[model samples]
Target chain A: MPHDHHDHDHPAHSPPQPDDKVHSYYQILGVALKELLIEKGIVTADEVRSAIEKRDQITPAHGAAVVARAWSDAGFRTRLLTDANAAVAELGYPMTTTRLVAVENTADVHNVVVCTLCSCYPRELLGLPPAWYKSRAYRARIVHEPRAVLAEFGTQLLEETEVRVHDSTADMRFLVVPRRPAGTESLDEAALAELVSRDSMIGVAVVRQP
Target chain B: MRGPHDVGGLDDGPIDPAPHELGFWEKQIDGLRGVIGAKVIVTTHENRRYVESLGDDAYETLTYYERWTAALSRQMVDKGLLTQAEIDARVRVVRERLAASGELAPGAEDVKP
Candidate 1:
């Protein structure tokens, strides 16, 4: 492997040791660029801080809200699948200009997302992707071996089921709306939304009954 | 511009199923770039192209946000916000301050191929 998945011998995600002053070029570059931009009056520090916080606040729950609503309301589902940008906006998510495509995972078919080029995700809807979602392993393998990768994520499909991989790009993002699990008819919209996990929405796993 | 970063459908290593929580510095980089990108000074397309042009080694060594930060720096410099010399000087200063403050990360200067 040309790349070391482990970062700088820090035991898998250990807290930054106190002497962590040695900065990578990116960190230095980030600080430098931020400083210059601020000095140039191009952007304010508070502006950047708030933007990050907003973006960081997005989670699968946002997507789950949409999905759970869709499950209860067929009209909303049609709107989401037909025009994701407008539908998501109705719920207050301002997405990129790139269109969002909602792929339905039915009994015979499944769906997943990846940006084979460089991790182009729907940040407005799903927040930032996981590290593995952007890994060389996933970008390379998921499209070709969707079943195998899905297995790794604990998603086992029936022999008759079909797996579909959505290749995200700069112009489009794919969101998987997994099938509504069984035995939850009595559950309310909020409760149903709680059953939807990020992994399930990513098409790597199924929403489980609770 | 086409290289290893475009790894869709290629065989590679195992997926780390860990939850990738962003740290403060990572959030700062994202925040900074997000603010800059919003100004229309540098489009997301241009920034992504810059990141892809970083070659396989740096792309592999750096984390996702690190690449974003590096590419943001390059684009900012290219966009006339900073000269290469100016940013270089700033990097040096950051290093000194960090070292003096006992936050000096060891071997951070080494960029291995």
Candidate 2:
């Protein structure tokens, strides 16, 4: 493996040791770039700090809110299916660059998403993708063997249901609007949103009553 | 002609759902990229293309943010925003300062790839 070359200097079969002191080449390069950019008057340090905070502010809960509203409001569901970008904008989380496509799950159709080419996730709505979502295994198998992959996530589907996997791109992203679980009519939007997990929005698992 | 990054639908290992906590340096790189991207210094498309073109050795060997930082540095040089020499000098200064402050481990520079 190409990565093996990085371990050549170490004694063979030695356990990996975590070093907190030395900065790697890429880490140094990243800091240098940031400092150079700030010195060049291209961007301020405050801008970078604020940008990180903004990204951290977005999480799976935001997507859950959208899904909860869709479950309770038929009009919102129609709008979400028709124009996801506009629908999300109504929730004050507008996508500035890419278009969002919310794929709906039904009795006979199950929807899932993957970026075959790269990790093109809806970060604004769901925060950064989980580590598994970007793993080579998930990226390689999700598109072709979705049933097996979903099964690994503890999501079992019936033989009659058709599984659909949507491949995301740089300009287009996907969000799985999972079906609301049964017997949740008494729950309000906030409570319903609480049941929605990050994996469920990625279509690996289904939302369940807790 | 599949890029090294285009690993979809081929035989691979089982999915490891273990989550990794983002370190301080990783978050800073992400923040820098976000700020530069928002300022139109580099588009996400360009970032992806650069990352894809990093060759198989780097694409496979480096972590996600490592690739991003490498690509971002290359993009900065290509765009004439910063020169290679300038970046190298800055790196040296950072290393020296850290070492003088006893933050860098001994023989760390020798072990660098």
Fraction of the reference Cα-Cα interface contacts (below 8 Å) that each candidate reproduces: 0.69, 0.62
DockQ for all models: 0.56, 0.56
lDDT of 1 by residue, A80-137 (tens): 9899888888878867678899999998998988888877888887888887887778
Error of 2 at A5 (Å): 7.2
Clashing pairs in 2: none
Model 2 C-alpha lDDT per residue in residues B61-80, reported as the tens digit of each score: 67788788889989999999
Q: Local distance difference test, per candidate?
A: 0.79, 0.84
Off by over 4 Å in 1: A1-22, B106-113
Candidate 1 lDDT over B19-107, as tens digits, reads: 66676778888788777777778777888899888877777666777778777777877877788899888877876676677665666
